[model samples]
Target: MKFSPLLAELINALTCLPGVGNKSAQRMAFHLLERNREGALSLSNVLHNAMEHITHCQRCRTFTEDEVCEICRHPEREASGLLCIVESPQDVLAIEQTLSYKGQYFVLMGHLSPIDGIGPDEIGLDKLESRLQEGRISEVILATNPTVEGEATAHYIAQLCANASVDASRIAHGVPVGGELEYIDGNTLTHAFSGRRKV
Candidate 1:
């Protein structure tokens, strides 16, 4: 039997999420329509609000509703002068969960992927260069993923730090090669963040 047009459209929309295939989308759509229209409505409202309100923080480039994120505005974090650079905003959250780092962050939003046409400018490197030129940061800890593109991005940023007379380091312990920082366990990530080696 064919699903009604609206139900089919809902299922198709649900499939847009990563890892949610047709069967999963159909299951979710049916579950929402069958058992929890109220929950679905609530989810829809919250998602709509977040999509409309959430934006990148001005200084760190992390997702926030404000012009500057709380972390960037914190006095202690600013005084610390330590900057941790990551490939994505999710990485910032992952490192925060480890509770081993208390410093400023620069979220690239993506790595340097030439094949995909993503470059330094596309990932907010110009803004990062402006921040580095400010001379407020003393060191930059490269917390980008262990992938090839991540490494390349890190090295490129390290050069920028060098140009700005800031120390640069790469996270060097516990994190496995080729693994994403977002997926690493908190303890391992903590160790990696704490054991960063000078680049």
Candidate 2:
């Protein structure tokens, strides 16, 4: 049976999310229509509100409603002497879940991928350079994933830090090869952060 045009569009949009295939989308559409139209409307409202209100933090670049994120604005968080670098805000959340790090963060928003023409400036490295020159950070922990692009990005940042005479280190071996920090367990991530070594 053919779905209505509106229903088809909604199902297609649902399938745009990662891991949601056409079949799943169709099932979701049917379930939402059959069981709870209000639930579907609520989901739509949340998505629209988040997209409209959430934005990158000024200091750390994590998504937030105001100029700075809760982490950057928090007086209790360690403000000086430590900076953890991660590819995305999600990675920051992943590390935070471990509760092992209390320092600041620098979110790159993306990894350096020469093949895809993504450069340091494109990933907010220039902004990071200015942050480093501010003289508040004592150490920079490169927490990029273990992928080829991730490693290359980390090495590039390390070189930059060395040239500027800033202390730099990479998260240690607890993270498996080809694994993303977002996927790593909290314990492993904590161990990696604690065991971080100079690069």
Candidate 3:
């Protein structure tokens, strides 16, 4: 029952993905190897290319190749008095699928987890503050998840924005309590954005 070094390495690499344990990684490796070499190659190529091109947007921390994301640079999007703040790029994607929002987005990239040593600056709150100071945005919608950490992070950001004189609000109801935005349906996400409550 000895495997080649190459196969072992493949399993180890697959395990690097979040939630992929040793057994799952081994299963994936064997499944990919047994079915399609081209699929595995395609996955590798895409991962490498994405790693090279995907970078944080200067304005919003959302992943993009350019300085600003398509959402931020789009002229059709509402330029004044609107903003949606979320915890990660996936959350942004989830909301985008709803097709109800036509405003800019600011991705926090993470929640405030003090035990994990993640603080405000580490999550780029200062950058957000600077963006607020630019004096064009009037309403900021905090779209962070409904978890404890996410709520705390939203409250912290809302307080910061309020102190700087920007109107802030949290995502409206419809998003389930103790649920993450990624799992929410498109219609629900859209409804949440439209019905956001002032904080």
Candidate 4:
């Protein structure tokens, strides 16, 4: 139970990862120190580099080390006139895994929760408004999670899209209520994307 100060610090730092508790973090720290220092060093380097260089894409707000993400730079994505809005970058990866969508994305980084003090501007809705006003996208897909907060965020964005005179839709069908896009299966994601309903 009594670890060296540095080891304790390593455990605490590892616990910052999602689902990694104190016990798991201790195991990881111990494993790294005892068996895989090289791998741990590699992980540290990559993490440091990612933190230093990764930034949001100017156009869509997804993580990118460059000025804009590859998806945003793709001409076909703009030509398609379709934009899928997601709560996080993980959801973008999940949807991409399904290979059923070939459209642009707008990552909110978080959903709207008024009690938490996250409003339209907090989640970058002002940037989204600017993007919508550009008029390149003809349809906006509300791909937020099915949680109550996610629903609220989707409805808010739908209203924004409507105000901009762009068609808006919500993904449904195989995706169950309260399910997150990051955890949903590929078939369900594909079905949900394919069966999107007008918002």
Best by lDDT: 4
Q: In terms of TM-score, how similar is model 1 to the real structure?
A: 0.85
Instruction: Give per-model CA RMSD.
Output: 5.9, 6.0, 6.2, 6.0
Best by TM-score: 1
**Off by more than 4 A, model 1:** 174-199
Quote the lDDT for 190 in model 3: 87
In order, what lDDT does every prediction score? 0.92, 0.88, 0.89, 0.93
Q: Which 10 consecutive residues of model 4 have the lowest summed lDDT?
A: 171-180
Task: Please give, for residues 1-199, the per-residue lDDT of candidate 3 as tens digits.
Answer: 6679999999999988999999999999999999988999999999999999989998889888887888888876646568899989999989999988888998888999999999999899999899889888898999999788998999998898888899998866588889898999987788788887789
lDDT of 4 by residue, 52-112 (tens): 9999999889999999899989998889999999999999999999999999999999999
In angstroms, give how far residue 119 of model 3 lies from its true place.
1.0
Q: Which pairs of residues have clashing backbones in candidate 2? A: none
TM-scores for all predictions: 0.85, 0.82, 0.81, 0.82
Q: Between prediction 1 and prediction 4, which has the larger TM-score?
A: 1
> Which ranking of candidates, highest lDDT first?
4, 1, 3, 2
